[model samples]
Target chain A: MNDQEIIEQIKKGDESAIDFLYKKNYRMMVKLILKNSGTEDEAKDIYQDALVVLWQKARNPEFVLSSKISTYLYSVCLNLWRKELERKGRHTSSEGMDYGENMPYDEKERIHIVQKCINELGDACKQILIYYYYDKLSMAEIAEKMGFANADTAKTKKYKCKQELDKKIKTQYTPSDFLD
Target chain B: MELQEKIDQYLLDQLSPADKTKFEQLIAGDSHLKSEVALQQSVVTALGNTRSMQLKARMQKIPVSMASTGNALRLKWIGIATTGAVAAGLIIFFLTGTGQEKNTESAESSSIQQTTSTEISPAVVPTIESTTPSAESQTEKAEQAVVVKKQKNTGTVAPSNEIKAFDNSANFDDIENGNVTTPNAENSSAPANTLYTETNNKLSNLSVTVDNSNSKDKSYQFTGSKLTLFGDFNNKPYELLELNNKGQKNLFLSYNNEYYELVWGQMKKTPLKKVSHKETLEKLKVINP
Candidate 1:
């Protein structure tokens, strides 16, 4: 499909279009990262991240892509890899490197606990939260997708899911229980 | 619930200027509100990380890693080349006629073969007279073939129950090397009682026509796998038909309205022999219907 057709399908949240976009640009994106001294795994991660960004942006009704989709994806990958290189300190000497490279023990523990809590949530609650926060889909779109009667039903469900998740996460947040 | 929504709004940066300023002031003043917003921010961050991981995992599952993709493209090229060679061989096989007829007739037809010539007395001369190509051209068609209903005599006359399908009495030499024009070719699906059993090496390049005349224009086609030749028998459309009787396989082609038997195995060695063509084709149309 042409760029506009792929854009339209992605806007409608077509899963195949995401797969198509990912495969069609995989080699080019990977080559970019490899030429910049990134490993294959690192290249795949950066490219997938860029494609996810495209998926999230295309679903926004107000978003207008002015250039070819390939050009936009190429630019996103380039910018993202540059940031990665800077973070790794590969662009400069490591003489002034600090111990701030690793995540704090407490923060990592909290993140693990949060992921477990999210997984323990019921399917509907989990999907509603992801759709709202990560996918950034509007309430009406969620209603149609989740087969709720209307936007109000979807909103009400999101509120309940968030409250349940908060309760779940709070109950698991004792540092003494996870003192490793 | 109201406080919780405000905390979510502040964490997501979705609150307006006035609401954001008020919420920040509240966060600075109250330690509990600040901790609540911090807890919520961590949850949203983790959610994004988990989703991104899942999407990447899905992409890795898609088919054909780069290492294997190159091999698949090479294999496809090899397959195309093999098919082209097979088609070229068949075109050369049909354009040049092989050897003449050799008797592979089974015991059933041979037992009645001696009776056929004896039964063809002076009275049967009038019956054979009507067996000429001009007489049968009225009902002749290129796609039409016969079933082995008249297998009694490999020579000519059929018994009472036997149905004669071809007019085999045409002059063999005149039919083979004559100035003949082919009929309009028609193609049809192979019926349950099909005339030709596909060769283990099925000649799909059947577009080659017999070059009896000087012009190299090809009018013969195996139209849709039916072994029909759309060539001329004196301006009439002539067809080739395959007849299977008992354990024997017989292939026939026509020129000047006279049918020549194309011996199966001896194709390269056998000359084109004038034999049973019309009577067998007539029965083939009956059985196919």
Candidate 2:
């Protein structure tokens, strides 16, 4: 069933509706939570809380659909994961971690080398790059999250970071450079 | 754009299709551009890989804290409106007590007991201003205004309104009160009663829709939870409907103009039972009818 249909069934207290929802999104939810520094249990807890929230909102007649269910779910999971990180008093540097199972062998090695190069680059460059690319956060989100002046400022910083990375890579040339 | 600018735009997937083609052509013809593009790409790829690993490793060490105290969550909700109601009641009790005592003293001091108009006025004001009793009336007016505005704007009423309760405030009040009432005052409540009063009645409609869906044919029976609608902890249990459907099931519950949906799946049986969505009507429903 579509999300709306499932949501309708769930409102009526249908058990199967809950089952179907869990099955469809559990894998992606787990992956998302794990990527946000959540363990398997944390992922499960956040996912469960998200489900309850969904259920509560579904029962509330006032809430209108503004986006796809998956997007909403992902947003909730992300928020919860971020909260988890904050509660632990740890800063998440999700930089240089390989979570993409779909990466090709050559691409993976090249990526590793590029990551090393980035590490060699300044910390500012690394943070900007991670904020923009790996997090897939919008310039606005990044600006707000990182305390940038504005989206324009964040974009400028990102541009400078990219330039620095490029400059560093040019200085250190290797034929099998990607393989390192 | 400069070569660096073009390369940056290309890496970010911001270049137009035509620009992308031009850039690709330029890179193919020039070994220098190719090398530059490869180097830039490598940096991005490496960052992506590193971030993913970091996130994964971080997740491994981190344990999920409970978002809320689950033990309190269910009961807390069950008592939500009741807590509010209890608080309001206490405030009213104190105010009325003080007012009555003052009125008695005034009567003793100066024989003015015909009405005690000021004292009575304050007591009534609290009842009205508390927002518990008069919410329906205000909600009704707001809904009417919205309907009129929508009709004027669109020149038509939506089809869903045919199924939806036109008198939302009244129906909400009735539902919250636990009255087997229908939204239609003009049309008899008999039809809606048949629809909601029996498990068999709702099943026929749900089953027909489920049977027609494209999924594989499978029959399963599972008990559903009904909303608890009482203030007192002790109340007779009401049996919830058992849903047997193929599609992803979501149970929608409405209370006091608010709506909630509960979703669960792959369950041997329903996990949650008789959750109150924190509505005053539930208290009324259990008490009045």
Candidate 3:
């Protein structure tokens, strides 16, 4: 199908639409990265990131695609790859900044604990949390995506999921998990 | 707003700067709001990570063909380069086999260059003998002919009197216009110059070989489009050899007892750079390309 139809399917959360886009643009997008000094795995990673970005943006009702989906994906891949290369350069040059060691011990523990708590959440709650907090979707958009009755229902569910995740993490929290 | 909504607004950075400052002060005073915001921040970061992992997993599972455009483009990049020698050989091959009249006149011309010819492989020997035309019959036709003088035509260049072709562009133009005369050649009476027009049977006769073919003897042919001289002989005939060295195809011309490298131009006449370098001339002298 054409860009509009595929976009509409994505807006409707059609998995097949994602599959179609993933297959159709896979070669050219990956080839772009491969030509620009990226390895196959790196190319695949960048293209996937670009696709996810597009998929997330397509969920916004007000998001107008000013270009073809492929063009949008290509631009996204290029920018992401540039950022990735910059990150790699910085990572290589900044030898003393070991990321895990640099972070506060408690903060690292908190992230680990929070990630574990998040994993315990049901798939729907996880999707809702990601849609709102990560993808920055509005409550209404979350409601539409999660098949909630309304924005209020989506909001209540999100708050409850957060509370559940917080409770799970708080149970695991100890004096040692906090800095003095 | 409910405390949770207030906290959500602050956590999402949706609050105005003044409101955010006010909320930060309130949270600073209220440990509970501060704890809630911190908890939510960690959750957001974790959720983002989780979503990325999920999306990445899904993408990695998507099957792509191994023989996709990536490899195709790579192969195309390799295809971008064609060495100058192979290209020039192609040019010489096509330009030399154009005239039908050149084939008929081959019996006279082909034999004249044999003694001084480089090693002639069966494949490179053009089927010029297939087309035989009379010297007198092809007098007018000789002007547009493509000529090749094979090794068998060695007698055409008698060792008794050495022949020196016209050394200048004006004379080269005379040769190009078929104004040269062999005893049996009906083209010219301008002395010394012989029209050696030998046409191969098929234009598909192309070779990508080395220069060692012109190792010994003196035989050369200056015909329609190009002049190829082979072997080393006493007369030191002005012979032009299309030599493919390294990846470059260069024309090393021996004319008027001097060696010059010819650079082809858009027009009929091209400038020849004189080669006084002994090593290069000796090297060129040995190549029977």
Candidate 4:
């Protein structure tokens, strides 16, 4: 099947699609992990993780496959291995590292905090914000998916959700907490 | 427009050129505005991360039975073949030893045969052969070899080697201050060097194409990893711009005419500072060059 068709099957939770995806990409994922100092068992773990990530993306109504499925799977495995390497404190020079590894620790922490606050926004606000910002859904689409009266209603809901989210974050964290 | 809407637009890069310039001036002039924008940008980012994490959690619960059936069978075959090879080698060793002993005639010839048998025996035969009185000892050695080979075949030899590598490096203080010989130092570096070369090749060849026109909602794929950017506009179907990153994470692609800039970190098209196409090209040149 074509990429779109496969994606559609995955979205519908087709077992065959999942099987096909795992079968097709498992070798590449295993090879990647093995090359990165992981064992066959670890490769299996990483490949499973990558597949889960792909499955998650496929299940999301908002997710679009920007790259070939194999490419996307390969990227996921690479990132997982990089993170694994970092966690193990086995990170070598940039020659083998991925780009943007130098993101400030403080920034990462701040993003983590904001994510916690977003999660606390409850499912309604969370879905709306994700659809609007991350998914880049138009107001009309958001309204339709969210069952709002119209686009304007979705806009108002989104505005309020942002306000509520901002308030939650500000109340929990001071500006210094993030800056430091 | 409300301040929040303006910030959202600014973060998403939906602001007009004039408004974008004005927002930048505001950010530069006011620390509070700068922090507010920063906070807002973080919220957008957090939302993106939260979504990814949630999806990951869900994906983990998927049944392993859904994995390819062929893989399981292949591993089984490998295990069986390894077992057979170990058994075959043991049989050959025994057969050669018996045949040689029977063929030997004079004292000198017998002595030579004994020497040769003793020399080659230690390698395939376990140390227990000399010490153990029980016949079970032979089976034990064979089993051990099979077990070691099986573990090796499973690709699990790296973790111990990795641990050893770390331990050797950690003892550098001792090595520098004293004349201690580090046996594991060589063992550690061998795998790491081989792994590095192999990883580098795999990483360099890894590429993922970002389709600008695929999804109605402008959702970008991120795998929460470091990324290197490579832009290619000449591809057919969707305009292809490759993000050659280790893991696909938090990339936002903006399509203008035929040009595409796959920005790292920022999930939205908007950056706090205005970035012209010329600046983007310069950035790509820095990355690729």
Candidate 5:
């Protein structure tokens, strides 16, 4: 069933809708999350977290969906992946990140350069770039999740963080850093 | 479009094909625009790949039990409720005094006080009914009725010694039928309404135990000396008996059929009443006996 039908069933406390939702989107959600630099385990965690948020919010009487189920799921997974990066970055430096560019590049080179640059970037940079570019989250949503003052502040921070990431990559590599 | 905004949107794959062609034209001739695009493109690609890998790893680790979120939440609440109940039990055990001497002495004096106090106020006595079931069903129905009979002129006065005596009788009946499970089960066997002042030292040794396999690690206690004040006096006496369990003094209050652990020296001016002891006893009797 579609999200609306599933949501209606869920509102009635029908158990099957939850199962169907999980089964239907679990793999695609995982794949989307994996594209954001997470492993299968991280993908599962993000998927579950997204599912949890959806399940909890779906119970609210006023929740309305203005997008497709896949879009919503992708957004949630993307947000969760950013959070995971932020958490990991707290204890370590973002040194060699695996993501390469916004345009779909040669998947292999894209994966290698992205991972290497991501490894060099700081937690803050990793989170902002992943949210805006990979997850495609709005600046406002990113700000709210990260506890920033507002969307403008988050956007400013994102710009600074990206510059920082680019600088770090240039210092580490002699070639005109492919990842600006 | 503004230069930075245009470059930012172009790098993010958010720009339209027309804008993309414009960006390509600029990149072909402009060093700064080409450099900006190069940096942002590399960063975005890196982010996407890392996310994809992380998602793949997370998906592989999904637990078999992930579908049982509702059950998990229910179990969490059940654990909390059980912990609250056991903590309440320990509180009641401590407040009522525990050792043999104190238990016996408190049981004896409280019974006598209840009898004399009731005789003094004959008009207030309600019809006495024995609802306690037979020995086979003693644990199932150990109702200790403590009716503090009073005339219209007097307010809801304290229960008499007769009621305490009646509770003691019921307690004995519970012990005889193995209704209680504790080292201090002998004392708990007495009706819940038996009121003994803190003077009895043995009451300190009593403890209530709740053993559930799913229960948590922490245990709680209520000091008996400060709380057992429902005797042959007015309601004001409870205010005096109310002692706060500040800093782990271990005093708990039983009122309205719930146990509250006193914290931060905030003691109630009045004793909290509980759902009638008879009702709980009846429930216990049904479940156990």
Candidate 6:
């Protein structure tokens, strides 16, 4: 079944939907966890936690998945695993946390402010920024995926969105605010 | 170009080397410019983290299930639910605990089998001698013996021990029951037959018996590069050994569910099927003989 259909079945509390989801992703999830310093049992546990989170989100009527179900699940699992690693004080270098260690308080606050600004930039700009900065997609690729006329159009839009984000960030708080 | 655009390019490393050097100089000269670059870098890092979190969450939404028998399938679901609850609690505890406590807790949890020898048989007693042959290791040997005694009393059985040893000179019945005496056994005047028993524990425990009578070479060595398909673990077939074609003596020992590929007594993790102790010993005999 398709992702939407699976979501509908889950919303209807169909057990088979849950089974279907588990059977489809178990191997990949297990491999991902195993390669990331997790044992077999730990992989199983993380998979289940991710499923539970998906179930809860599916059950909510207001919850909308803008991305594919697999994409959403992957993100959730990655977040959970990173949090897990952080909690355990295990090395996170493998997960691209080179700058995470010994981050200054002001730098952290600045990032937090920037994140808030990005969040307020509306879904379109947020997605574009994520696609450009996070996903590392080329402007042409982002334009094609996001349904823009051309790469140049996407570039201009991204610049404007970034400017708006920067403006919001600067207006939200001063450096002195972080000192307090 | 606007300073903001230049800063973005600088953060992304899109600037030419000369431009980057100039930007660095500018930042070094101006505290305001330095702070701006740092803030922009932080922004990029934050966005990267946000994207990572999103991607991880999406990947996790995929379904997972284990292969199981008819009645066992039902139990598997029940086990999943139960374990999920337990895992949730553990995650909370891990998050709340201090860093040192978390490390201690994780260490204790992983070594639970070592501390609690309730069900599994002591399968490594024979292999331990070949692996660590120092006078200072008497305490570890005694501990292993105690574990074996406890396993013997519990009446746990291993499928691996059922296979007879390959030594034509030794009685099949005696070897099958792990009643063969080693040189150490003879020297110490003690019976040194290594017995194996299977347990439901996922931890791998394997022991190999070296036939030292032929060479008087107290140390056993394995020389093979091709791993042979020997047996299965939970129905998953795995190639257990890569035999050295040159006929070099090598020690093949499996302990605690880990295959130690010892090349000249230096241990390295080898990718091999988790097999019964009997299978490993039999394979060792085949390679050596």
- Each candidate's chain A: what TM-score? 0.70, 0.48, 0.67, 0.58, 0.48, 0.49
lDDT of each: 0.50, 0.42, 0.51, 0.48, 0.43, 0.45
The segments of candidate 5 whose C-alpha lies over 4 angstroms from its true place after superposition are A1-111, A174-180, B1-4, B30-32, B57-61, B65-289
Residue lDDT tens for model 2, B1-289:
5777677678867778998998899889977667767877776567755554443443333332322213343344335434543554566679888523322111221221111111111121111011111112222222211111000000111111122111222332323222313323223111111112121222222321122132232222233421222222111111122222221223432222223333432224222333354543342222111
**Local accuracy of candidate 5 as per-residue lDDT tens digits, B6-32:** 777886566779978877987999776
Clashing pairs in 4: A66-B211, B13-B270, B223-B248, B227-B245
Candidate number of the best lDDT: 3
Task: State candidate 2's DockQ.
Answer: 0.07
Candidate 5, residue A143: lDDT: 91
lDDT of 3 by residue, A1-180 (tens): 345767776665555566656655565466555555667777787777777777667655557765456545645565555555555565544232222455677777677888998889899988888878766777888898789899999989998987887788888874234322
Chain B structural similarity (TM-score) per candidate: 0.27, 0.25, 0.26, 0.25, 0.22, 0.26
Model 3: per-residue Cα lDDT over B1-289, one tens digit each: 8887787777767889999999999978976666777776777667766876787697677665434323343233223222332454566668877532322322322333221112221122211110111121232122212222211112232221222221111222222222322221221111111222223322112221112265554333433333333443322223444433343445555444466665533233333457887756654543321
DockQ winner among the candidates? 4
- B1-289, model 6: which lDDT tens digit per residue? 9898898778766789999999899989887777666666766777766654554455445432322212343244335434543565577678888423333212222222121111221122111011100111222222221121101111122322122111122232332222333232222211111111121122122323223243321223322322222222211111123322122323343322244344532233233333346754544333221
Cα error of candidate 2 at position B232, Å: 38
Against the true structure, what is every candidate's RMSD? Answer: 29.7, 24.8, 29.6, 21.8, 25.3, 24.0
Q: How well is each residue in B30-136 modelled by candidate 4, as lDDT tens digits? A: 88878888887788778766665555455355433222323343344345535555555566569887533322011111111110011112122111111100111
How far residue B35's Cα lies from its native spot in candidate 1, in Å, is: 1.2
lDDT tens per residue, model 1, B44-132: 76777666666667787765233332334324323433343344345546665553333222212222211121112212122221111
Evaluate model 5: give its TM-score. Answer: 0.33
Most TM-score-accurate candidate: 1
DockQ of each: 0.06, 0.07, 0.08, 0.11, 0.08, 0.08
Sorting all predicted structures by TM-score, with the top scorer first, yields 1, 3, 4, 6, 2, 5
| Order of models, best lDDT first | 3, 1, 4, 6, 5, 2
lDDT of 5 at A130: 75
